[model samples]
Target chain A: MTLTWDMQDAKSTDDRDVVLEVKDLRVHYATPLGDVIACNGISFKVYEGETVGLVGESGCGKTTTAMGVLRLVQPPGRIVEGEVLLDGVDVLSLNEEELRRVRWNQISLIPQGAMNSLNPVMRVKDQIGDAIQTHESRAREAVKERILELLNLVGLPARVYNMYPHELSGGMKQRVCIAMAIALNPSLVIADEFTSALDVIVQRVVAQTMLDVKDRLGMSMILIGHDMGLQAQLVDRIAVMYAGNIVEIAPVEDIFEESLHPYTQLLIESIPSIKERKPLKVTEGLTHDLRNPPPGCIFQFRCPYVMEHCREVEPPLRELKPLHEVACHLFEEQDGKIVDISDESVV
Target chain B: MRGLTPGYLIRRLGMFVLTVWLGATLIFIIPRLAPSDPVAAMVSRLLAQSGSVEGSAEMIEAWRARFGLDAPPLIQYLRYMRNMLTFNLGYSLTSFPSEVEDMVVRALPWTLGVLSIATVVSFVLGNTVGALLAWRRTPGLVRTLLPLSFTFTAIPFFMLGILLIYIFAFGLDWFPVSGAYGRALTHNWNWEFVKSVIHHGTLPALSIVVTSMGFWGLGMRGMMITTDGEDYMILAQAKGLHPRRIFWLYGVRNALLPQFTALALNLGLIAGGSVLVEYIFAYPGMGYLLYQGIVNTDYTLIQGIVFIMIMGTALGVLMIDLLYPFIDPRITYETR
Candidate 1:
């Protein structure tokens, strides 16, 4: 049986269901020196059948944020405090049994490295079947048929059912992971750098498979990656993270067209183009130490329009426009127009 | 065989034969290089027993011809290889008229029974202990107590055997001091004899298992830790499979691959038994036979036992090589 959601029915932001809501989520990695703030009080929401791209540079806690939301952060990293409410259920407060039942059934993960994400010794069917079988028991024949169907859903051949993970190509392995994540049709799927290891051609194929599977299943997704171009093409909205904090988040077009945060501006400028050769725009500041962040806006040191007040007060994430939020002190909404309020000398 | 190509199987078996041949040739040459003649040594012993012997030179010459010592070294080497091919180890030097193979046959069962059981028990117990040691969910008391089990690994097995014999055999009188079975019982498959055999075999087997299990446990612990950190391990946890399933299937299954190769090599040593442990217990196994052969300088007996051990080891490696692809689908001999 096919489950379809009418795209036209829930067009309004108010009418759409919030499938996932991550609020004040903080994850820390323990060390002898101190705790490294990996995901520093990050918050976001994914509406029903919406894809929110969490894009950032390497080590900016995009994966950690997803892990924290899924309650899969490994030690010496732990979710210190916050709420990860999936479908209005408080995931952090659930007992072990309850948490397990929720995982992969309500929210599955297509991990960062698809090549290594699968158990090498197990066959493809078994790996896909494991996710399905863990939450519910079914007849062996039915499980086999369902696994074959899942392989087909991801555009993989039926022969892949009997093959081990190593037998499949990288793209095929990625599709297997995608199929596995959507096996139970979880409401939300977290794809963490899912296409990073693949070549450009394979990346496109795997990305297409993910989009196809996601559309057919109509699941909410948090696609965590660093590919600005890919994010622009695939996601409805984009969240730009820096130094363990989301510097800016908006509809993809708004993010690309009129980005508010300074870091987002630099990120857009850095996207390589094939048409012309331009000097690379390299922002000239290292990220502050994660264990001890500076007491202000995280991007203050790198922002071109840094002000005296920006160094002392941590800029809160504020909604300055419809469905657009930015964490910066440079601009303010005046009569529905974002006006540059920074000191002229600093600009 | 299912995973192995005919070419790979032939190559592997060929390698096994080459190993046995090399071992046999080395043993033959090394003993010859020592400059001690077995016949001369036997004659000297006889001379020491008697004040004078009539025509001892002539007797020596006749015996040398009879034993084929008169042949050139090259001829002797060829004959030795030919005999090895057919498993035709000659008569023991000290214990004349007894065929080396017959004695080995008599001792083989005891060694295989005791050591094989010990090897398997130690491997299983050690790996289980190791997996538990590395497992995050293991109970507090178990984690504390598991290291104590490895304490015996630090001591040599024979020394542990001595300690066991002193405590359980001598002090408590719970079992016999030495031998493979009770003196009163006849060798049979009946319960009383079997029980007695187990009783007698306990300390020797216990010494081996207790001492060697720590090595296995430590290796397994290291592998389990590495396997636990693999990317699939995190995905397995995220899959929300029960902790037990993850521990055994995802964790232990992958961790156990290297250990299987180790177990194969260890199984090769079974034909030799623990030379010292068997000596200490006076158990009638290959180790005890080897000890007697060394003491008496019975070249044929020593050669026969060593050859059996070499064959056993080569056979073990071959079996593992052929079977590896079946256990781990990733390993394929078809490529080789």
Candidate 2:
């Protein structure tokens, strides 16, 4: 884990405004086949009151990274090494008792699969109330008031308070989940695939609700999802992940306009936007098997402009502009020369 | 809070009629189809009482007509159902004119007392233990208990009764091996009679509880295990609720739903009594009476016992269907 990582070239962007800073987060799952490196040394930061979208296709460790942030990774899948600093406190260093205090009060997760997440036998209000009452001793009326406030914030009616999970529609359940996530006013809320399960109409409503709640409550959020279009609508900055690694991190407009990484460009092009309706640029090759990933770049096999050195060593994430980083040899600065990777490496 | 829509109630009541009618039809046909003519059996027993050398043909016909057995099978079935519905089970053929209703009344308390206590005790013990086992799942403790509980369920009901009687009654001289109470304690509301009833009921109740508690425990344990791993459970943990509250309230409460319905249905069938277990212990419960009814070809008694059982089961099913929705907010009695 102490392997030499080349971050000296890039200026340290760690600031007081950073709500959460995850450094070299690695998570591995011991399956029957082999150890699957679900998240491999992925690092990112979420600024206070800013929504950072972790975008990737399925099985690319996007969700794993979110789990690492919340310290919710369970048995068989262990967070092997990482330093998760939330508000400058290392959450990873906290023991079980301390983690409980940190979990819902400081950082909560609106988990994936909204349909199966809430307790079917419990009322939605109690579900939210339980999260509140767990950390603090509050009067019954006080808890009820807080639950009502949360429900209102998520755009759900007060009538939904007494209803069970099964009685609610998918959209309502997701709202309840979001309500629970924000019940304690956690400084950071991670919504994993918050709207993926819903149809287009419900997705838009849920996305709107997410924005409203985030803006109103003023909490940093990490929205992990597969839909780039949906992520683009909600997040200020997007981190594009590919096979347990983030290939690019840039503002949403910058990613859509000019992406330095080949994978990022391919991902942006793959989105079927009405504005970018030129042609369907199909990304070729297959996703890397996490158990037996290649020695060099995980995206090298799928890169349209693959180079010799791309197959030899992995490129480190480097800042090409302020707050924009790209992990590709194309952006590398060699000695005093800005190496023309386009002429030498474009295949 | 729809309060069970009228449509669901009426529909369920209609189904109940169908079920009871089916039960009555089975009872009506089963005796007629049997080789032993109950009329003939009653006639012979009657003739023997009178010290007749051989039953005359005329006498047999007279007795058959008197009992309405000479009519067509359909008319006889109708008459039988009318008698059953009116709670007049007629005279027991083997018991020599003793009303089947009276005999049933005499035998019911013995079975109910033993079984109700056993079922309730075991249900409480099994479910609590099962939940604890699921919550505090130490591998070593589970490894030791899993096999023993499974083995208890594997042992046949009567075999376990006999084994209990051998170990606790005949060997240890701890309890009476047979009968409802002490012979010296006359039937009364006195403490001695009640104490004797409980004292004698111990072995039979123990057999029932010991054999079937394993089922409830294992069922609840399995339910807890599956429900424990569910998304709601993870959500509970993420909620940062205390571990104890989560285990009992969220974990066991959901797990206990299936077991609750099962228990209600089983307790509903308690009217039928533990047949072989009661017979082995000689606790003259409804099961013992039913056994005697079958052996003596007492169709009236058999029909009476079976009707009670059918009614009990139907009521149990109906209660679960309608009342369970009220018990569990997840269930809805509204017509889909």
Candidate 3:
């Protein structure tokens, strides 16, 4: 539940400050059956001017976690426990008026589906201008100039401002989305699968633009995606989530080279690379049903090296190395039994 | 860009021709096949007026033959189609000197005016209310009002029209009981006439509004509910868009697309008019003209009214279709 980052180093070394720090965040959806624990006690820190990669499988609660951070959860899904501290302010505790000020000013989000995300009736420029005008009491000319600047920053021409969402290409639309997200120079940007819908080439362009904007604006980001390769390319640090829990938190290099958790190890190994033609190693079984999760480790059902004790008790995230934490029974004991299996048995 | 493909234009023209042919056939055949003799009805009306059967059966048969009622159903249908294509809707039996097209021209504008105004009023008010309800975290009073509005929508337009007439006309005496204008104003286009027209029109307009607004509100509310959950709406909120801006621009704007299509459809019906509303208000519109046509079995007048209604609907749909690309460039015939 505790997240400790070198704040002094992060502030002094980087132009971007520590924008958002989520501690022991727990979000659950109340369903007819019962409460489905979507995000169960997760913690991470996003420093200013850096992109933190949140990589997980489809049902690993990545999107839910993002929505919870924004407090945009619809009825039945609520943030049960969490401290979403944005620039030292607890976003969860703010009143509507205070939260309204904080939301678009401190943090902005680039949603997953760029294609049908825009209002079909409105011009692209107007949509961006709308964002600016809503947050700030600016003159029309100033807002228009800012919108054009944002559009240009995202590699869109000034002409696109007059065009409706449907007129723009997928890449253009995504850029418009990015422009919208960065309109107010928000301290932190949460892009939930923003580039997942684009082709690889477009995805790369969008991802690069995001990084470029972050660098220029000095805004922090949480880039959520399932592609490990994409995450490795964009994010400075990676938090690999598995079944509502962050099993591994480390720098990009450590996650790939010295992955401690079995889930993180499996994820790293599964990334298709040019150097190796080995078949991808995938984690076995589906994500555990959150409504009635087993008493022990949620990943125990899918873990290849699950022991008898693993099914009886849960494992706490313990620091395996400097700035690297892993939550798994394999790393729980000093001399835990080590078992090696090929890709066939694991799958 | 050519705006329309050649194939699309050809297909549309072909459909238009087919629709007209079908309409002509149905109008001609259904009346003939109604298991009642129009000649007998005409004869009965003459007898009722004269209080005696002065003409011979042969004379009555000759009159029927002159009108082409003596022909077989299929032949009659084909003849009607030919006349329709040539813009010759023939003479009204009830009003012999007046052509069907003339009667339609006289009555069409009134219907169009009433229904068009009603349609526009309902769309704007309903959508605005629905969007507010969807977006605002308003108090219980506003929330309670929404269900009542929905209840108004559930009632048929005719029932609502009657209710409005009772309350506003009979009970309150605030508006005229019937007709488009007061007798005192008498065809004048002055302020007095305008005021009287507005007064009389209120109950009818209210009837249309109360009946139809609910559908639009419900539609807009539902659309907002779904659209509000969309990622972009959340993105807008995260962008620190003021709550009102988020609702109107992000939430309602996107939600209005489908409602626009529905509104377009309703606009098509404006020329046709609300038959029940017209009857209740005794409004001199195409709806009442249609009523007279049916009651008198005025074949030519009915055909003319039907043709005009068809053309109005076709043109409305076409206009809406043409406007789609301008509104949302992603939409196109090719995409479908």
Candidate 4:
């Protein structure tokens, strides 16, 4: 019956346009003692023309996951195992030259710190021109026009074309990075906390510029950051990572309203609310060492609702509802609704 | 573009002039501070040579009068400053009738030709080796071998000169051991003179280059390492730029800024620092002239050489100051 259905599914649909697919991607940083698993076999797919927010607290492998996808992790950090499929091509399998050709042309990056992402000595035009010229050799005038077009697309003035990175303001620099990321009109762009270094007002402006550009260019993006507020404003789907593994991933509203995993629920509660006065939620336990994670769930040590089964068996990410996935042992699908099996009574 | 304003230029030039003035005054005061007078010292050497010359006291007085030493201290200072401005340095005490200006002019070309070549070669070679050593993508064998080239830096350049002379001159008989050119070649503007000069100056130049390149290499390696961690470098890689392009345009270009500043300082000190090397090789340059002046207590010659050195150094610093804004756009003088 499955084979017959597979034959009938030969034509691809528009909604299933998976621009980037990261499967079982494991990244590790080699230390003297052992490998510290930064991204532990995390998998996700980014559909075309949508933003996926990889959200977690600092050091929870959000940035590592982005770097792993770009193949830009520095020394001591190694992509131990994984396949980063950009437009159905395995990025990990490419040679250096081949990989270089694939980068920026198909997948560009708006780096973590926009303040230093640009070459200080280089002019804004040259830095943006580098991305475009590397992939396709265009006439000088054409390249210049395209660069100015990109700057305008990101809501920057034309005079910025001649200015060095030092001459620009922080928001302008972040916008410059955003402009460069879209210079080549890449299929997938990874923006790693692109606005984390800006003021709140500037952050909003830059975020709006990003959204406008992404909409105009019709590009898919992975926005990596810990700002839940920003994620809510920008991203379509949110992947909440904990201890190097994505614990829960779902549509934006559902994760905010009906998060399944205990870690996800705590994360939602931790979001600061201005309307009500409540005691701050302080998690009790510390995170386990990444180099030596326990034999059960990654969040077991910090999970407030930890149980006997959670301590002995590692839980796999399972789809408990349509488009919502959770990695916790307490929840089970029963009668078309997720129910707490451990409660021993119906709610 | 904004830094090369006329006011900034004038201020920079004013600073250069101040440096030269202070340096000139110090050199003048320092020589006079010594207990022995140049005339008296000359007389004593003559007396020792001829076993008590007749009327030595009269001769000393007559010589002092001829050399304008009979003037008061203030008069002497005014005269000295006047002569310095006019480029009319007095006759050497030991080599009378041979003006200090002529001696310097004759020696200047040889020193500039060889030393400049050596300095530029060492800087380029050292920086390249250093950059490659720190670069992550450089081949291991190349990195390993590059460090061995800079080992000569541990040895004094004169010592290296002697070693080169011993191996290449005495042992192999491939090159001349001493002097700026072969005895057979006349000093003229011709290919033979240039070739013979190069052939003879090889050992001295090689000694300086090989010994000093390691300093530049070590400095460049440190800078390259620091530049490697810059956010731009990672972003450049992420942009899919060619590795060679990133290494040169981003990595080496930024690392080379401090090295250029150091180069200017090294260039300023070149004339003074080559003394030992020149002494060992008997190369007739400013350093050799300096050695002669020191040994003979030729006050005029020494003063001339020191003034020229001060001028060269101040000029070098001024040039670098003006060129800095072009090199690093962030260093604009327009704000001030």
Better of 1 and 3 by lDDT: 1
Give stretches of model 1 more than 4 Å off: A1-13, A343-347
Poorest 10 consecutive residues of model 2 chain A by lDDT?
A1-10
Please provide, for model 2 over B129-159, each residue's C-alpha lDDT reduced to its tens digit, 9 standing for 90 to 100.
6776777434676656655654677888899
**lDDT (Cα, tens digit) per residue for candidate 3, span A1-347:** 33233432333344555678888899899989899998998887787677889998888889988988888876778999889999999999999889888876788888889897787777887788877777798999999999999988988899998987877889899999999888898888889899988999998898889878877887788999999988888888899898788888888998888677778878877778898699867667877788888988888878887888789988777654555667776653233322223322221
Instruction: Please tell me how candidate 1 rates in CAPRI terms.
Output: high
- Candidate 1 chain B, run of 10 with poorest lDDT: B1-10
TM-score of 2: 0.92
Full-model lDDT for every candidate: 0.90, 0.84, 0.80, 0.89
Ranking by TM-score: 4, 1, 2, 3
lDDT of 1 by residue, A112-198 (tens): 988888998999888888888889899989999999999999999999999999889999999998989988989999999899999
Native interface contact recovery, all models: 0.78, 0.65, 0.69, 0.82
The TM-score values for the models, in the order shown, are: 0.96, 0.92, 0.85, 0.97
Instruction: Give the 10-residue window scoring lowest on summed lDDT in candidate 4 chain B.
Output: B265-274
A126-181 per-residue lDDT for model 4 (tens digits): 98987888889999999999999988999999999999999999999999999999
**Model 3: residue A12 alpha-carbon error in angstroms:** 14
Question: Model 4 chain A, poorest ten-residue lDDT window?
Answer: A1-10
Candidate 3 residue pairs in clash (backbone atoms < 3 Å):
A17-A48, A104-B240
Best by DockQ: 4
Clashing pairs in 4: none
Writing each residue's lDDT as its tens digit, candidate 2 over A1-347 gives 12212342245444548898888999999999999998989888888988999998888898888878878777788999989999999988998788888888989988888999988778888888889988989999999998998899899999999988988999999999999999988999989998988999999999999988888888999998878888878899999998898888988888888777888877877878676558787878898788988977888888887888889898878765666777887765565333547774322
RMSD of 4: 2.6
